[model samples]
Target: MSSSTEPLPKLFTPLTAGDIALANRIIMAPLTRNRATHGSDAPNALNVEYYRQRATAGLIISEGTQISQQGQGYIWTPGIYSPAQIEGWKGVTEAVHAEGGKIVAQIWHVGRVSHVSLQPDNRAPVAPSAIVAPTKTYLESGFTAVSQPRELAAEELPGIVADYARAAENARKAGFDGVEIHGANGYLIDQFLKDGTNQREDAYGGSIENRVRFPLAVVDAVANAIGKGRVGIRISPVSPANGISDTDPQAVFGHFVEKLGRRGLAFLHVVEGATGGPRDIAPFDYAALRRAFKGVYIANNGFDRESAIEAVESGRADAVAFGKAFIANPDLVARLERNAPLNALQAETLYGGDARGYTDYPFLTEKAA
Candidate 1:
């Protein structure tokens, strides 16, 4: 446990990447808090308060906002393509900025983690190959086993890249400081990057360069739409979530990160563990990947206060992002400054409805009484 009386180290150090300057090295990782309204997937008042409460972090990555209707994977996750949705996100950006916080929108596509009910006219989900994910997606109604996805034709690849570009434009319109391409956790981008899911033999698969083509194209398009200084990419090389795995992960991810570093993007966010499973099972080499990426690096996955601080102090990472911890500790920056104890998150209330475990968690000052 961290001691409250110890003199605080310079954990609140300022950082500069490209044109943006952050107040500290702690960031709030994008977390899906399935509180969007049914049917429309629009952000509600609770969503506003949820983000507003955690405005003290150096940077806040908004939950994975779907880039298109087909990009959705879970029920009640927010979207960025609609006017109402953009308006909702605008309010969130404004609130955070008012408190001197910077925010980035995470654009996503779920690929095969989607259900039939969520698909286009009950069509099969889309992927690089016709394979079903080895896992199921949790929904409001119930869990739905993943079905084989329709392999994307070469002609369809360009449009998917365009969708990511358009979403980056939408984030700019919604007043975000930047955008983070969600290429991690077995989502659409990861599905395209991993050989276990992408069995294509054309220009898009069969080799390490081919497997990373789609994700790189999407990143290039996004960086073009928004300036490279305002774009970041997140990736989890060994993630088993949503049934994604890569053979020769070192070669694949090493090439990916090296290429991204040349792009001069703002930062690279790496989730080092099996993001959705136990830590012991993850397979990527964080130290090797860190050496591969030359730009600013933000490390995520199962970090506590001391570990997070050590990561920065020891030069292993430029910053650290928190997921579950930020949910209960709204004033996380303040808590770290004061060396206060953190609030434990309730697993049941992570997704789905209302303020019970969402906006109702008290600050340490309030909890002390």
Candidate 2:
């Protein structure tokens, strides 16, 4: 569709981020559907089909996979801890690979954004401080206010880091191409990073350097488990998702990104503004953060076909991750290439549901037929 004078657009060109090679720059962002196997909390046939349908994405970052039962905040999400869970995820990885797609596990730990019922033995959730987040977690009954959390002891920090490393290893064993550390959306790592939730005076929570210590440690351990090239991390500087905020995100994230640059990780997936909300909900310089990271920089949060092309063509972002768009369009890459209309999203089925909104989204070719 182009002449010799114009080269292929960067958005559709091949890219190598660390060890993972991609056919295009369009990526599928992690979306939690709460549709994992009910009792096991493992990926099942539905999950496998759901991902397989969207394998056209250059890369698929799996939903927030809990590293351990204690790390869970919502019901019916998948985990990489148990043997059965590992086997269950193997089916998913195989399906994605068979479709010639690269996938990564988004390893996660929800700090205080959890209900007591979701915690291990109904114990209180743990966080950097004992403060409860002004958020609600999805449960079997319905959405409920998150429970008060106990302050995590400094000694327990190593164990949490170890859990992340184990999850990375488990992901590789389950045939994942890599792992993406979930450091965004007011999750465990985000709780430790922001000043609002992290009121601890201990070494893990006082200053910016101290706050970023645990996240970096987890990065080190996960990279050690799998190769550094097989690891990426997602961060939200100003996103107040799940009631997280910082007094000065620019200074905090600037230093954090600078430290990440030295690690030579695969990529940095950043939620530029408010997670799942307005991109300009707060004033923060995402470009500065992008410049700080040395590897591929993935820009997320509210991007369309035109903006995606512009971001990649101008080198503002190496790639663009689409969440809701991918949910509504399985043949998103082809649709974007042809500038085709995307199917409307079924809002009610965004969370826990059957194939109606999950795998039943018709392909572009099917519409033509």
Candidate 1 colliding pairs: none
Steric clash count of candidate 2: 0
Report the number of the highest-TM-score candidate: 2
lDDT (Cα, tens digit) per residue for candidate 2, span 138-198? 9888788999999999999999999999999999999999999999999999999999999
TM-score of each: 0.95, 0.98
Q: Which 10-residue span in candidate 2 carries the lowest summed lDDT?
A: 1-10
Regions more than 4 Å wrong, model 1 = 1-10, 276-283
Would you list the C-alpha lDDT of every candidate in the order shown? 0.87, 0.94
In order, how many clashes per candidate?
0, 0
Query: What C-alpha lDDT, on a 0 to 100 scale, does residue 109 get in candidate 1?
Result: 95
lDDT of 1 at 343: 87
lDDT of 1 by residue, 1-369 (tens): 236785545457888766578999899999988888888888878888889899889999999999988898888999999988888898899888888889999999999888877777878889899888889876877666876788889899899899999999999999999999999999999998889999998999999889889999999999999999999989988868887888777788988888887888999998887895565574557787677776779988898888888999898899999998899899998888767888888988888869999999999778879
Error of 1 at 53 (Å): 0.1
To one decimal, what is the Cα RMSD in angstroms of model 1 from the true structure? 2.1
Q: After superposition, how far is residue 212 of candidate 1 from its true place, in Å?
A: 1.0
